[model samples]
Every structure is written in C-alpha cells, then in structure tokens.
Target: MNVTESEIIKIHNFIDLLNSKKDSIVVVEGKRDASALKKLGYYGKLCEFHSFKGLINFADSIASYKNLIVLFDGDRKGKYLTSKIISRLEHRIRIDLSFKRKLVTITKGKIRHIEDLSTYTRLDRFTVL
Candidate 1:
C-alpha cells in the first residue's frame, strides 16, 4: 500500500512529541503497549501500571515532574483507566491522548482496538478526536 505524505508527517509529529519529553516517564497500560512503542523507536522512559492504585501511586510519585503522556490502549479498559488517572492528576500533569489514533481499527463493521495501528490502515490523515 502507498503511505501518504500526510501519514509520514503525522508519524514525525508523533515522534517529535515522544522525543520532546524524553526526560519524563511515559505512563502506559502494559508491556505490550510499551513494546509496540519501542518497536516504533520511542526511546523515552516507560512506566506500566497494572492497577488503579498503582496508577495513582505512580502519578503521585511523578507529580513533581509535571510532564507525562498517558499512552493507553484504545478500548473500554483503557478509557476507564484514562478517566481515573485524569481525575487524579488533571491539574498536575500535561496529558495528551494523541496516540489513540494509532490504536484504532475497523473490524467487521465496528471500530475496535487491535494490537497496533499496523493491523489497520496507517493513521496518516486523521485527527485524534
């Protein structure tokens, strides 16, 4: 398939966002998600939370930094977790969910979360909303 110029630009923008916060810890869902990001060449620090309490604790510990990107999967669990996390640290951190565009896919007439964006079409021209 042909990778559009806009897709390349979007990928670069995503990479720039990741690299801009290389010093801060990136809070993600689990190892798989982190691994997928690493495969995409993200070299920033990654922190994985297995539970809500753990997530809270992690957020509390990093409250001093004031820079964090919550890169969770695009699913119900991820949305729930994101809401919980945002509620706790809404004022303390700068959270961005731009990566969700990279986790969405169309499956059997419905949009769903696959392992990664590579399973579907490249998110070249779409916005995160």
Candidate 2:
C-alpha cells in the first residue's frame, strides 16, 4: 500500500505532538500500544487502561494529568472502552480521540489496534538511499 506524503507528515506531526505533551497522560489498551507509541517517539506518561480493575481506578490513577489521550483499538471493544472512559472521566480529564480516529482511517482497514500503528508509520523501512 502506498501512503501519500501528506499521511507521513501527519503521522510525524502527531508523534511530535505526543512527544511534546507535558501535562497529558496517554491511555492505551495494553503494553503493545504503549510500545508502539514508544517506537513513534512518545516518551510521555502512558497508562494501560486494561491493567486497571475498572474505570474508577484508572481515572484515579491519572487524576493528576490535565489531559488524556485515549489510543484504543478501532474495534468494538475499543469503542466500548473509550465510551466508558469518557463517560466517567469527562468532567475532570480532557480527552482527545482525534488521533485514534485518524489512525484507524489511515491504516486502510489493515489495522484496528493502537499497537499496529507503528507498522504503518514505519516509513523508514521502505525508504531507499
């Protein structure tokens, strides 16, 4: 699959934005999701939503953060989890879902989980010098 230059640029910008975040906590589905973000150069705080017993604990764990980036899978479970998190944490935590939506669209239906993001964004492997 050929991704346009614009797509690469957007992914780069997205990674940069995540890396620059200081007051935000990224909530991913699991360790793989966190690893994918690490591969993309995000060194900020990352919490695995599935690790917590429930939304209450997850929200409490990240209560200190001013913003939360929920990078869940694009699948049904992901959507349900995202909704639950938003419903419980919306008042205190600022949530961002744009990245996940754009990522799901950009993958061309090849990927549904956040962990797969690295596979699409790894343009370096296809580049030739």
Candidate 3:
C-alpha cells in the first residue's frame, strides 16, 4: 500500500519530535521497532520491550528520566503494553501518545507496527510528521 503525502508529512513530524528531544529515551515494542526508528535516522537512546516483564523492568529503570516516549505498535498488543508501561512509569516520565494515533491512521489495515512500516516504505521517503 502506498502511503499518502500527508501521512508521510505526519510521520516526519513525529520523527521530528524524537529528534527535538534528543535526550529523551524512546521505548518501543521490540528490536525490529528500534531498528526501524534507527533506519529513519533516529539516533537517540532507545529501549525495546520484547515482553511485558521486559517493559515493566525497563520502565522502572528509566523512572529517573524526566522525558520518556513510548512508541509502540498500533495493534491491540501494543496498546495493552503501552497502558501497562504508562501505569508503571507515569509518575516520573513524560509520555507522548500522539504517535500512536498517527501510526494507526497511516497504517490503516496494512501494517501493525513500526517494523512493518519500515518494511513497506523506504526510509528516504519519510519526512517530518
């Protein structure tokens, strides 16, 4: 499926949010998600949660960081994990849920996560979200 120009723009703006907060750590679903963000030129610190336990542990560890961004997949599992992580770390970290909406809307019925998005769209084509 082809991504619309507006969608690409939105994705770029999302990416820019990450870029602007260079010191903030980005939490994702898995290594693939991290890889996808990295391929998009996101060089900030990133942590991947392969499972619920990992996510909780990571959240606890990063409680000291004032800025934390969770960039999970748009699927059911991702939403569940996001909620859990937020519940665990909401006190100490700043969270951005905007990416979730943009990702879900852009992906529509095609892809479920960042890794899948990277697979379907070339990195160069991505602009400011």
Which one wins on TM-score? 2
Off by over 4 Å in 1: 1-9, 51-53, 99-129
Per-residue lDDT tens digits for candidate 3, residues 1-129, read 676766666666667767788557778888888888887667777887774367557767776677777788777898898888778777767887766666676666556777875753484455443
RMSD of candidates 1 onward, in order: 6.5, 2.3, 3.5
lDDT by residue for model 2 (1-129), tens: 566666666666778877787898888999998898888778888899879988888888998899998888888999899999888888988998876776666556667777876764577467532
Candidate 3 regions exceeding 4 Å error are: 51-56, 105-111, 120-129
lDDT of 1 at 61: 72
What's the lDDT for all of these models? 0.61, 0.80, 0.72
- TM-score of candidate 2 against the unseen true structure: 0.84
Strongest candidate by lDDT: 2
| Candidate 1: residue 58 Cα off by (Å) | 1.8
Candidate 3 has its poorest 10 consecutive residues by lDDT at 120-129
Candidate 3 residue-wise lDDT at 16: 70
> Model 3 shows how many backbone clashes?
8
lDDT of 3 at 118: 75
Which prediction has more favorable TM-score, 1 or 3? 3
lDDT of model number 3: 0.72
